[model samples]
Target: MRTGVNLAALATIALAFPSASSAQEWGFPGLGNAEFAAITAGGPAPRRDLTGAWDPGQAGIAGGDNYFNARTVPPLTPLGKEMLSRNRPTHGPYTAKVFEGNDPLTTQGDPSGFPRILNYEFRPMRIVQTPKAVLMLYSFNQSWRIIWTDGRALPQDPDPRWFGYSVGRWEDDTTFVVETVGLTERTWLDSGGFPHSEALRVQERYRRASENVIELTVTITDPLVYAKPWISRDRLPLKKLPEETDFLEQIYAASEVTGFKQNIADKARTQ
Candidate 1:
């Protein structure tokens, strides 16, 4: 499969907060502000100073059940209402890759045929700092990114990206403002199987609420899709993994490759 990303948006995200306050604090549970010889051993370049391992207290709520799948509260608008009524796909300019059974151009489709969810939480989304950008390293899918703050603006003409594009600016000494746009209509927003359209805008605020606690407040807006903009807040605990490291991945169903794909093609012909 091809990966579509907006380099300019990612560039903006990668360029922020090179030297964040060295205040001996982290933002998650299962891990904490602990000393790691590896970090200090090398002047903190590969420091494991990020949030980790958490239990949201609810079954299936951990990385296993809810990745951004937290219950959202977005007030719906009229346009959003109409879109939900039919679940119609977006019809416009697209250069998306086509799968035999999936909506080739539309952003929504999974081989599972059922909605997908993250069977677990990534827990440690360690923030790795570089001079130009802040990289949020995820233990899930080894999926990570460069949050750019290079004084460059988002590109006026950007290709559609699965993750869209993201840029960040400091809101205050303790908070970061992130704005993401130009995303593909295909991604599921949460592990609980929430979906979004291409015209989505995601605004996220990273706030260090306490010495060991950080809060992520997300506001998602998509007029051509959902009935309202949605918001969710997540609290994470800082963590430490001194003895080891970890990661995860997902594999789509194989039966859909032959069975479901043919089914869709057959229906199209009779219609």
Candidate 2:
């Protein structure tokens, strides 16, 4: 139901870094506003059936509770190493606590699932589909972005953001390609707070492999923050309306807090 407040403007802010949680008094400039804008932008409101049903392809492996469970994800190179070294936290499970938003992760903090300083970047992203656009729903920190399928151009010197601006175009019937830019260094690439500079450019290919399944392939290229292009994908089943059970409800009730235990465990080790 939101209206013309400049989708390009909102896009420029989100495609910046990882996700967020609560920035008590830290006025992170465009970050909070971008979050507000994400909640209220776009003209021709997108669809809501993305929660209907979902199917993962046979080739898709079970990413498990933690996709980066110290086993999956690509290895970090020297630049990646440098980024981590420079931003690595002093104590805790992974890095710092700045990545509770933008990053697409679960409530867990340990990306390696190992003990280290934790800069958590875990969030659950929902999907809102329509004939003209696709809205990715983020539950980690109430973060999200609007992918304009109606054809738009990227802004110059955008206001820099945590999630950045995303614009999508259909390659085929079931496939959607999205380009995102205008990010900040304040966020992480995943739950582990894997680093990425503002030069980060994200390209995603989303396709409905079947009637009830959707696959999202992401290609991240940021020469300043990464040595090679970071590639990964995710799968989700559409939560059909007829079988309406609010997944977010369950997540908040207890499942989401499961990650908080890692923080507790981290504290135990430090003591």
Candidate 3:
């Protein structure tokens, strides 16, 4: 219920790059390239700790298109192709007109399910590590997810969930790896509306490359959808924020979208 905010601009920010002025005020003011370089070079990486706010600036936005390495994705299975055809997304290779888009999150205010959440509109996030779990708090949708660190195996046949279940372990002194499964197929793989089945499995590698930088890579595996595993994110760099940094509230509520369609989108369409 943030009022008086320009809904069209918000849509632009989510589907494209935010205006420079808007970027400065949203989610810890993502660092410019020079600033990121300077900060990352300032200190040595700490050991086995990822507790702080992190943002990847424009890099995390995936250019508002196919999030997975678009050029490298294997041909989709027949089922995957059909699912993609059904999705009329406003961004990415198979982009459609805004009015024709049926993006669940954008049009119906649905949760921006797992993988997609990390692949699209990636904003500032805070990571809190505990003995039993790692809590990830995202600026988008004010959402959070937990990556269990208690050494439990993933569920064999779990109920589908928006964010799915996740488990994490340290691959080395500096690399933390997470695996996720049981994701609901209601969500797209990225803003491009790539489809995944409930059988999708996602792996995230978080390497603390420096005190001020964590490099992340995401790999997707879904035999039912993709012919082979492919990378969605390739070592995307996330810069650390000050401990005291605060994030802007960014939520896409149903009523707000409804209002935008009536007052902005519909009117523009008519004009």
Candidate 2 residue 67 C-alpha distance from true site, Å: 5.1
- lDDT (Cα atoms) of all candidates against the true structure: 0.42, 0.46, 0.78
Model 2 poorest ten-residue lDDT run: 110-119
RMSD of each: 13.3, 14.0, 8.2
How well does candidate 2 match the true structure, expressed as C-alpha RMSD? 14.0
Q: Estimate each model's TM-score.
A: 0.53, 0.55, 0.85
- Model 2, which residues run further than 4 Å from truth? 1-79, 89-125, 130-132, 234-243, 249-271
- Per-residue accuracy of model 1 over 1-271 as CA lDDT, tens digit each: 2111123322322243211122233432222122211112111112222233222122222343234322443544565444333332222121112232234212233322111111233334456556566676654334566667666676565676755567777677667677777766555454333456667777777664432334566677777656667664444223233212332233333454345446654455432
By TM-score: ranked, best first: 3, 2, 1
Which regions in candidate 3 have their CA more than 4 angstroms from the true location?
A: 1-29, 32-38, 64-70, 267-271
Task: Name the top TM-score candidate.
Answer: 3
> Which lDDT tens digits does candidate 3 get at residues 1-271?
3211134423433344333224344445455554444343225667888887787877776663435545857889999999888998877787777767788888788888899888987888889999999999988888999999999999999999999999999999999999999999999877778899999999999999876679999999999989999988888888766554578777889888777767765666532
- Model 1 C-alpha RMSD to native: 13.3
Residue 263's lDDT within candidate 3 is 74
Better of 1 and 2 by TM-score: 2
- Residue pairs clashing, model 3: none
Residue-level lDDT tens digits of model 2 in 1-271:
3322234533432353123222132212122323432332223322222333111212222223433433444556677677766554322235444332223234332122101011122223356667667776443344456777777787677876756777887777767788988876666664444677778788877665543334566677888755567564544222111112132311332344455545553444431
